[model samples]
Target: MEFWNDIAIEKSWKVLIGLRKEIDFILIGGWACYLLTHTIKSKDIDIIVDFEGLEKLRKKHPLKKTPFLKKYEALIEGISIEIYVPFYSVFAIPPEEIQKFSIQVEGFRIPEPEILLILKQQAELARKDSVKGQKDRVDIINLLMNSELI
Candidate 1:
């Protein structure tokens, strides 16, 4: 499987454009940041969408659907994408809060850098009970420090 860092910016653009209508929320991660700010190597595209919308999307795109709430990894024209519903905590973030700041991608707007940093930090803190806590912590730190969030 190709890592997120292995995907090109144009490929990310294609995927985002392809999925635009179905996407209610997109938290650009990994190499996707290049489209918004600067380029940085990242392993996976961490995306979140409204659970209800995702369910409807799954039903509509049955051929592309996977188990609910689990990472659905697939390659479309050689570009890898990882999809999943955000945890309740992440989803709990009010849309208004997210709307307060966002970046545009092909006419579709997504969370801004600061919001992304906040969410990543929340994800890191929430990982305390998980086996991957350390990795999450490191990722959160690196992303927060390097991204334009600050």
Candidate 2:
């Protein structure tokens, strides 16, 4: 299980690095949970890209907006890349503050576990639906457990 998980992460890193678009964004959501908890699995990568940054990406690659999910998406190498725009409105975290807590991974920046947990809590609350909320709850629990906080 661990070996396959490592292989999946390796593939994800390659796909991320292959993107032609400039990645000036902060990593968030499920992938953030995986980054924090090495054993966690994520089927998609979520990032909070600045509006302007996403616009620039649109110029280079096809991006479709998903109103229901409140994110812009582009499929790359069979991987779903969900990009959230306007940092403040989505996560209520200023770009500068996000930068402070971000760590560079394979040329990309990822949020710290603490920030990811806060984002997951907000997501869990905002998603009134039980099904969607369950994912966030699981992510929070996984993060807490892996971090030895609970």
Candidate 3:
């Protein structure tokens, strides 16, 4: 439950920013909560990009997929980043909505609150179904209640 401090978050933002021109990406999950609320402890940063973007990165560097997570990870300067291409149905956010809420981080814009919430809600449901998504459920509930989105 250790969330990144502003400095660390900024560093991570820089990493995403550095790749902006080559990919379409968005910050999501707990780390995104840190960015929006500045009150949660997050262990990892979750980024949702397009599959084409994944291929683009693969063409340039080595990235290994993490088993079961549908994510790939690469350490940039000692920090591990988890990247994935979100399935539209699972995420429940349209591309246009994502673009509307995206905010610039180091020059690369990321999904805004609305789109992030949609994904969080979907993830929560997925977790609830598995009985292992309690954390996701709790996080989503907390966010929705606090943000009055529920």
Cα-based lDDT for every prediction: 0.55, 0.70, 0.63
Single out the weakest 10-residue window by summed lDDT for candidate 3.
87-96
Q: What is the total number of backbone clashes in candidate 2?
A: 0
Ranking by lDDT: 2, 3, 1
Residue range 1-150, candidate 3, lDDT tens digits: 433466675676666556665676776776565555544535456676777877887887678887676568877654567776655313467554565677763343556666767777777777776532565665565566654335
lDDT of 2 at 33: 73
TM-score-superior candidate, 1 or 3:
3
Q: How many backbone clashes does candidate 3 have?
A: 2
Error of 1 at 53 (Å): 4.3
lDDT digits (tens) for residues 33-142 of candidate 1: 44444434444355656677567556655324455534555565555666555543233365445655677754656577666666556656766777345545555566
Any runs in candidate 3 off by more than 4 Å, and if so which?
1-24, 50-53, 59-61, 64-80, 86-90, 94-97, 105-108, 129-132, 145-150
lDDT per residue as tens, model 2, 63-96: 8888776678887666778777664435656545
Model 2 clash pairs are: none
Clashes of each: 0, 0, 2
lDDT of 3: 0.63
TM-score of each: 0.51, 0.69, 0.57
Scored against the true structure, residue 65 in model 2 reaches a CA lDDT of 86
